[model samples]
Target: MINDIGDLLTNLLFATKKIIPVAIKQSIKDTIYALISIPKTKIYVFRLNKIISDHKKVKGYIIYPPTLDWDYMFQRPQQLARQFAKNGYLFFFCNKSYKSRGFKEVEPNIVTCGADTRKSLSAINDVIVYISWAGHINFFRKLKYTKLIYDYLDSLKVADSKGKGLFKKHIRLVANADLVLVTSDILHKKLLLEGRIKKTILVPNACDFKHFNIKKTINKNFEDINLIVNKNKPIIGYSGAFAEWFDYSLIKYCIKKRPNYEFVLLGATIGSSFHRSILDFPNVNYLGEKRYKVLPYYISCFDVAILPFKINDITRSTSPVKIFEYMASGKPVISTNLPECKKYKIILVSRGKKDFVNNIDRGLGLSRNKNYILKTQMLAKRNTWDKRFNLISKYL
Candidate 1:
């Protein structure tokens, strides 16, 4: 009897081990999120269906899968949704969890809500499911859609954070995608080497040319930056995430070599610990972050803009959107020799310490030249998000 009991206990333990999944932490979080979202489920489902019913005659629904919150960062996903709505497509932006009450029409035809609308998506036809993150494949696979798009924006080396099992998911996504859009030439070539993709296109990052080209009066939004830009020294500024790949050492070297210039840092930081290291320099001014609406004013204040990124696989694969915004703001850009930025003749790509300093000096002179400003703005006009979207629409 004792021997039989031990054997049964052993069998149960073995079965339990096989039943449990990998990514245990993420699984727990999902369970908690679903429990908390239960009350709002009907509300969101109704809101989602209401928008769908209103636009039943439109050219297919454009589904933005749960990736980032509608307000978080306001980058590519937000831009694409607005364009989709303007083109007469109903845009549904689903969030990871319920952070707010009810659904809101973020833009004219773009409605954003939480995950309660997920199951409802699987029932709808004529939907174009657009996803960026590889981890979303599991849920998105169940959606009823006429087309599926995977935007390969960054290398996997920098993408994972939640202890994700990404490799298999990425392969499945690429294999089954109706269209694979890459943001850089490197990423595009990567797909070509994979050899079995359906169709791939290179749709690089772009800017809101009109938004950044505004002539708004510099209000209190520029108060902090104004103090530095008003000084006799020319200001070198940057705006973007201060992530792990940011070359803080390169920025320190630049600050040390150019003591006469006022260096200003804008935007938010992520996984960055070199704040104390760089801010110690007296010439360097950390201006903190600003909203996307008022970001143009901050960019306008800079005499020259900089992209001081570490040369690595993650950055090499990136098509920096800030470069286009800086160009649109009519500011001369000084950057490290990022392959993507190298294509732009207007950018002053630096090689060594002396070269970087020299480029900054060159940019200061160029900033004042009317023709240089015009040319930079013209380049931005050619690479607007509108143009990038229309190109993708052709394939869609």
Candidate 2:
């Protein structure tokens, strides 16, 4: 009878702990939204480059669609808004359906203009840069701008299968724009071949030197992991989605063969039968999804990082953000040889599972020389978001 009462008490406490926090969080969010108000603004930048220095004092707004919530990619809408606000740019985000409902009288500068607000883009008489492929085309067709720029950040066709149609639309948008900014040389070549002779520039992805300079200070979260790491034991790490494109079979093979080493997967596991099979491996450790800020900590724990992507059209025209992040971690990277990743000598390219295993061993055996670290840092510095945005600014 005493044991039953104790179990009941534990269950009640657990229930209360889970339920109370959710209700409290929702209440706080509502109160915060109600208390804060914004004024109407003159100019608006609709895309994600919220780090513009020139537009610090300019009266501008940002529009982020609700569609971003569909995928679990690294999205920081609130962060973007805050960054813009810090730089004196009025920031706002609205649901896609909000504008159509005529609920425009929320805030002046940071109004939640829904779908109907998009139509206002044409009459605003301000510069509008469309960042994504489909959204850029849709905005271009409707909105008139003093100077229009299409920031082709990725090859949509290779990024997702659903983006194939938008990829063609992006190509057309490239031809129509005043300036086109691409993120990869391979993509630049593809666009040029398709006759995109407009003011096109290649601006690769970038990292925050201050944030990613691991050599300066050891991140506290990583300090615990560092205690366990020894030169005698090699650690292989991969940080990203365990999506359909990820070669789990190759990962399994590597883990099976290299039983002595540890294989750590640090990311969200997609809900798929194939992904579930990865759990069967006793040597593999899935650290689950981590916050963006916490990622560098985990990455620093890795001896060698890997990009195990399957070769296909989806991967062919791709420029992965993880590649830059891996290099920024100052770890030797072994990637499956893909056309897009071939230009970087800092990465050891492999053809298949055999080559991947061999290269992983080679990378693990190599010394973490200062030359390699400097070379990796130089490459990462060149391909940062600031540089990418600067190239886009020229076209805008």
lDDT (Cα atoms) of all candidates against the true structure: 0.81, 0.62
Q: Where does candidate 2 stray beyond 4 Å?
A: 1-56, 59-72, 75-125, 140-144, 158-164, 215-232, 270-274
**Native-referenced Cα lDDT, model 1:** 0.81
Instruction: Show pairs that collide, candidate 1.
Output: none
Q: Which 10-residue window of candidate 1 scores lowest in summed lDDT?
A: 1-10
Tens-place lDDT per residue, model 1, 37-121, is 5544454556567777877767778787778888777788888888888888888888766654345787778887655556666
In the order shown, the candidates' Cα RMSDs to the true structure are 12.3, 11.7
Q: What is the lDDT of residue 182 in candidate 1?
A: 89
